[model samples]
Target: MATVKTVTTADAAAKLDELLWVVLWQPLGLPRDIRHTLSLEGEEFELLAQENGQVVGGLVAVWTGGTEIELRHLAVASHAQGHGIGRSLVTEFYRIAKTKNCERIHTIARNTSGEFFRMLGFQTAPGQAPEHPIFREHGISFELMERFVEQGTPADCSTAARSRGG
Candidate 1:
């Protein structure tokens, strides 16, 4: 089993920049400086997943005030896909969000990855705009999705739930 750990921007900047540059920016034709989007000025955080001491996946999330969080970036290494790394990172995010007293977490998932988020209990966010201009400019289409996190409720992290090994 892989392990997930929380990291600060200063601790994982280089690694995250590399991952997001390849997995997100380059593919989206967006500016390469991901720092502006992954800031840690307020209640924001990053989670990294590793297997046998190697980084495999990561995600960044920000608190949108008043019990809501927005997951900004989530990507797994190309070679590490199909393992449970992505799922583990998201599960850890849910665990952390609960600790922050968050009631809901939302994200704008790429069209290609929408089903992945859906399988993890997210549904189309109500009243979301039909299009996001910024991403549209870059030829990317995203869907807004959100998952509610009620107190004492076990988050359905994935369709086929499995124990997160220690």
Candidate 2:
């Protein structure tokens, strides 16, 4: 089973970056320069999923001002996609957001992942998604989605996620 944990050290960050590159950027044919420069501006942190001491998935999020967190990137290694690693990481993301008193979580999801976010209770937000020429050329699109954090303790979020079969 894959276990999720918060990423705190530079080494962990680098590992997560490599995982993201392999699972996301590389597949998209994005260059190293574009991938490395995609970091978001606010306070950022990450959660990583590991199995048998190997990194398999990860999430990057930014505290986007008052009561909102923007999930920047979420990816699972191709070899690990069938497992619940992605769900585990997002559940932990919610737990941490709740602990920080955040009231909502938002993400700019790729068209391919909109359904996945929907399953987690995120709704399409009322705004036009920003377009990138490169992504468009690659037949990829983006959507803005968000979900309000239910009023509860951090543990409550985890319990709720499990009950929902996430």
Candidate 3:
């Protein structure tokens, strides 16, 4: 099983940036600095999934509106997909949100990834997603998705609240 850990130091953040570029951006022909350009303007943090100390997946999220968090990016290496690494990262994200007293989590999910977010309990939020010509040209789209954070104790970090298969 992969272990999910927070990205605290510059090196960890750099690793996550690289992972995001390779898994989520590079294939789309996005610029190398795309991550920096799209980074949220508020309080943000990153989480990484590691197997045998190698990063294989990562997520970037930011606190929004004082009571909400927005998942800005999520990516698992092509070679590591379908192995629950993404799930583990999301589960840990839920735990951190609960500890921070966030009431909900939101994400602008790509059309290709909407089903994955749905499987993790995110519902299509009632709003129009921002338009991006590059994505549209690539046959990709976006949607606003959100999920309420269930009330839980600060110490609760288990997957019970957001595990697959209910």
Candidate 3 lDDT trough over 10 residues, lowest sum: 153-162
* TM-score-superior candidate, 2 or 3: 3
Task: Give residue 40's error in model 1 in angstroms.
Answer: 9.4
Candidate 3: what lDDT? 0.85
Lowest-lDDT window of 10 residues in candidate 1?
Answer: 157-166
Cα lDDT tens digits, model 2, 26-59, are 8778896665587777998899899999999999
Q: What does the lDDT read for residue 109 in candidate 2?
A: 94
Candidate 1 Cα errors over 4 Å, as ranges: 34-42, 129-139, 159-166
- In order of listing, the candidates' clash counts read 0, 0, 0
Per-residue alpha-carbon lDDT of model 1 for 35-92, expressed as tens digits? 5854544577888777787778889898877889999889898889988788888888
C-alpha-based local distance difference test score of model 2:
0.85
Best by lDDT: 3
Per-residue CA lDDT of model 3 for 1-166, tens digit only, reads 7998999899999999999999987987999999888977789989989898898999999987899899999999999999978877888898889888889899999999888777777888988998889889888899999978878543232344346343
Give candidate 3 regions above 4 Å deviation: 153-166
